[model samples]
Target: MLAPERKANDDFVYHSGLKFALLPAYYLPVWFQAIKGDSAVESGIHILPFILALVVATVLTGVLISCIGYYTPFLILGICLAAVGSGLLTTLGVKTSAGKWVGYQLLYGFGLGACFQTPNMAAQTVLPRNEVSIGASLMLFGQTLFGAILVSIDQNVLDGQLANRLAGIADITPQQIENAGVTGILAMIPSEYHEAALEAYNASLRVCFQVAVVVACLALLGGLGMEWRSVKETHTPDDESATEEGREGGEKDGKVDDGKEEV
Candidate 1:
């Protein structure tokens, strides 16, 4: 739905729909894991760290994307840590081990808030000021491509695992399993398959995390491409200006970049 409007619209309805659809999958698992682990805030004071991280990430991305030559190791570091932490949070949430819920939520939440807006911001900054609408559409086209792919891949992997697990249990028909509630499925499962069913679910979830990590890793690696492009754009403009000025400076007998043009 979002792919066609690469030129004129940028509402990102498809992208936003994809985001919200996956939010429940991401949020509930983390929320439950946190609650299960009994990690309560000692006080409201503990929430400040997440807030700070979120603010810093937004500010840093704004600087790096909106301002030229703002490249530094900190941007790379923040992106890596935040992406990996977000991946692990998905794993931890669904796996449901006893751990600090609030702490984990803050870690993952801040990581998400920090990086989620960066790409759109980059797309926005890349556009000329006059083409805001077209630029927005382009941004959403890109966003939709990635977002749709992510949700599709995750859903496919999960659903495939569920189906495969059901198939292995000869006693339970596919229709039977589908018809059954979580309770009914558990109750109807042959004892021999119970452990395997459980394992399949956990494995499916782990696979989902693996897929998400791969996405983040791809983006992280792709940052280099953005960096190269930025540097090239910055230098190209400077070079063009310098050449024009030097030509106007009467060529100085091939004295290029010798500040003769500066005066």
Candidate 2:
């Protein structure tokens, strides 16, 4: 809904949804492959903790929203947890334990999942029945746009970090590094500098996670802007038909207020 009172809440939920949707998709697996020395398949597998946690949290949040009627608390809680989780993830390094990574992923995933659906839910709640679909779709479009733009920015950050760190290390040239790719950069470096190269790669990946932390914090701020509102199962076919009639009548009368026909 574009009503003045609902604008802030709508904007907050939509932007926050962007952070929850994008972070893990861009950062976690790269961290696994580069820092943890995992193969593509293995890296994907290792992130199961996060994926599974997200799935569970998504389902649970939907159930809770249905039961509780209010989703504001969940949005606030999710962003806070995500920010904390991202902060913890930023501390990861080459020597970070498997347990720590898994735990951190779980935390981040659950946080993301808990509020990922809130934007659409809130949009549906505030929008008129006829406008709900359009409102929800617009929110999703913003989320997708954020994902595309942020991931590209993240890739540039990581690539720049690697190029700077890998310079002047052993006999490896930038050409060879670029030709071989990110994962291959370590192998191209001399064995003596492996530790340094590993640390560099870790540093780069850490930067990616750090971006997630910053985004999550911003998302939290957005979440905090959301209005407190309850969702209720009050819509019925009769109400929808009446609303449609109201719109038609409004159009005929050349007078409408908030989608209701003026008589």
Candidate 3:
């Protein structure tokens, strides 16, 4: 059986991964729409590279883990990549090119996707067969809970940063910006201040990404704490029980055949 501490570490890593992965995923569309002047549909379209990369990486990670029978290395590598990607994301600006943003998104997406499922795999590998459901539930809870909390925190960071940076503009108050919402904030500002507002907004986004970088880096602790165990070395309780039952049935049949022969 895997130690409880290791399982806890897996949960921490899973939670951290969700934060770093989701913070950018949630906000990038806003950035595209607000700063890049893309429509909602266009922003969605622009992020397709990120979505595709995540999907491919997720599937590839699962396949590789199954084939390699180990998950710890992926966990470590994924977190490192995520940290690097998050750092790169902080460089985004109003003038960032499509190619640069797309590349950064792909890097972040793959990094997040690579280790996204491994924590659950780790839980299953470490927990008892019957307790797998509980372990999975815990992961799910952490994902949902942390995702919501971190998004709220990022929103606050964005709001506060916007207020602070845009305070120089005499026409717009923090209250007005708060009410305008990110999508509509620029429209509320005078055309002359639009450039400054975009800069402030972009800087605020950078701050959010900076938070993601820290969160991703903290995940390394959890990754290091995870026990290095092979999935192939472990059997579920049901599998063991089935094997035992099959062996007993074979023994019983063999005894009956011997009795028939003696008779």
lDDT of 2 by residue, 85-172 (tens): 7788889888999999899889888987888788777776655676667766777677777767877888778877777887856666
Give TM per candidate: 0.55, 0.83, 0.85
Which digits, one per residue and each the tens of the lDDT, describe model 1 over residues 1-263?
Answer: 12222312322332232233233235334233222322334323344445565676667665665556343233344456555565665565334543453555455445555455644443343333344466566556766676667667666675676667767765566566547633355567677876666665555556666665555555554443332234224333334555677687666554456645334
Q: Which candidate is the best by lDDT?
A: 3
- Deviation in Å, model 2, residue 17 alpha carbon: 6.0
Separate clash counts for every candidate: 1, 0, 0
Q: Mind giving the per-residue lDDT tens digits that candidate 3 earns over 157-201?
A: 988888888888645676887788757887877889889888988
Off by over 4 Å in 1: 1-75, 90-96, 100-104, 169-196, 228-263
Stretches off by above 4 angstroms in model 3 are 236-263
Candidate 3, residue 130: lDDT: 69
Can you list the residue pairs that collide in candidate 1? 34-101
Better of 1 and 2 by lDDT: 2
Q: Write the candidate numbers in order of decreasing lDDT.
A: 3, 2, 1
| Most TM-score-accurate candidate | 3
